[model samples]
Target: MTARAPQFCSMAWAGRPVAIEHQWIEAGPSNGPLLVFLHEGLGSVSMWRDFPSRLCERLGWQGLVYSRPGYGQSTPRPLDEPLPPDFLERQALEVLPALLQALGVDGTRRPLWLLGHSDGGSIALIHAAHHTDSVAGLVVLAPHIMVEDVSVASIAQAREAYQTTDLRERLARHHRDPDSAFWGWNDVWLSPAFRDWSIEAMLPALTCPVLAVQGQDDEYGTLQQVFGIAAAAPHTTVEVFASCGHSPHKDQTERLLDLVTTFTGASSPNHANI
Candidate 1:
């Protein structure tokens, strides 16, 4: 099924307010569990295609999908400006919480689940680590705990593709300003200071149940990412998909859905109150 048309909500960023593009995949019960989806570095609500809806329908739950400040139809970051090394940190520490509040998501009222991909997965880890009381569970796909040489190399290739190929045009279909989305993410991941960026230190702080998934053939990150999460957060359940690439949801959708459904179903009785 196609995702619903997106809505917008405003929040402060870098001392200035920006609009965030969001959509609600409201399925199942009226008071069912809520699963929030965090898109990848260059991803947005539209970029997620119909996966969010499919997951929600299969699980008989609801979902929220959004694009961060610079992606999709949301506010566009200045093309000339580059993101800070701590941009992902800010998204976790600041942007996400604010967006949640703005959208009236009260975890106390119902269980809150986070499903993230790539950079989004990192942000989910950071958020869950700090806001342990808020998040019910996590499903992180190809998350990064520490920078990998492979990740940097792939991102560099993406940069070249953006400049020399039709990547920009392709991305424009999903983003109002593809440059804003691509450069904001690409610049930071490739920066020298970002090479040392790692959330391994923060994983130990996670108190919620976590389902960490990685593809055996993921070009961006290795299995060590999930292994690292499992090591730090012993409560984490790790799954490695064999024929998958960076996106198991796209590459191995049915398998991923089955794993996530089982993981979330066991985490809370409210997984599907309906």
Candidate 2:
């Protein structure tokens, strides 16, 4: 039998229509903390595999996983337009909050934790910095604090491989509009102005306890990314894994989950992860 196409739901953000495919796994109790998983630059909800469910079950918490606009079953971007520079900012300031509100997640009533990887990691950082009072904790894996020449080079290479190799076909399994996801992200990163992009100054605004993890073998970024978070947010705890790459949740699932469980369990000014 042929595989079934994924389904998506739509919503409005700032008067513009947006689409996002999502799944919420309820664990423990209705009042339990919410752990939101943010996917990588090229990732979607389906791309997360069983990691979110496994982590939620182990941690005894609820999980919220969704594909950002232009990925998975989410809304597709216009073919003629380039993605805005504030795409990440738009997610942090508008999309996420709108999503939570739509899902009936009350920031004032329950604790919220963010688990983000790669580009998602950067978005999580921006959200935490801007909405310090709402976020309980953060788990950033391979987040980019500043643009690096190596990152730009790797992204360029990925664009080439996607066009000339099987990368596009592979990505099609995870993205509803593969071209939208590919070009939306690829074009932004490859843009000349994007080279100087950095969120270092915004890091200091983050008040919640943070756990920054990075793989030693990550091709996209280096220890500097994780260390940058530590340096900016002194309350942050850092962990480095050997033989791991940009995707720690995928590469080092067990170890990364353990660190998340431990870090989230510890009580801080923000409500502890339970």
The best candidate by TM-score is 1
Worst 10 residues of 1 by lDDT: 265-274
> What lDDT would each prediction earn against the true structure?
0.90, 0.85
How many angstroms is residue 144 displaced in model 1 relative to the true structure, after the best TM-score fit?
0.7
Q: Name the regions of candidate 2 deviating beyond 4 angstroms.
A: 1-9, 268-274
Model 2 RMSD in angstroms: 3.3
Which model scores highest in lDDT?
Answer: 1
Off by over 4 Å in 1: 1-3, 269-274
lDDT for residue 119 in candidate 2, whole number 0-100: 91
User: TM-score, each model?
Assistant: 0.96, 0.94
lDDT of 1 by residue, 136-228 (tens): 889999998899999999999999999999999999999999989998899899999999998988999998899999999999988999999
Q: What's the C-alpha lDDT at position 73 in model 2?
A: 85
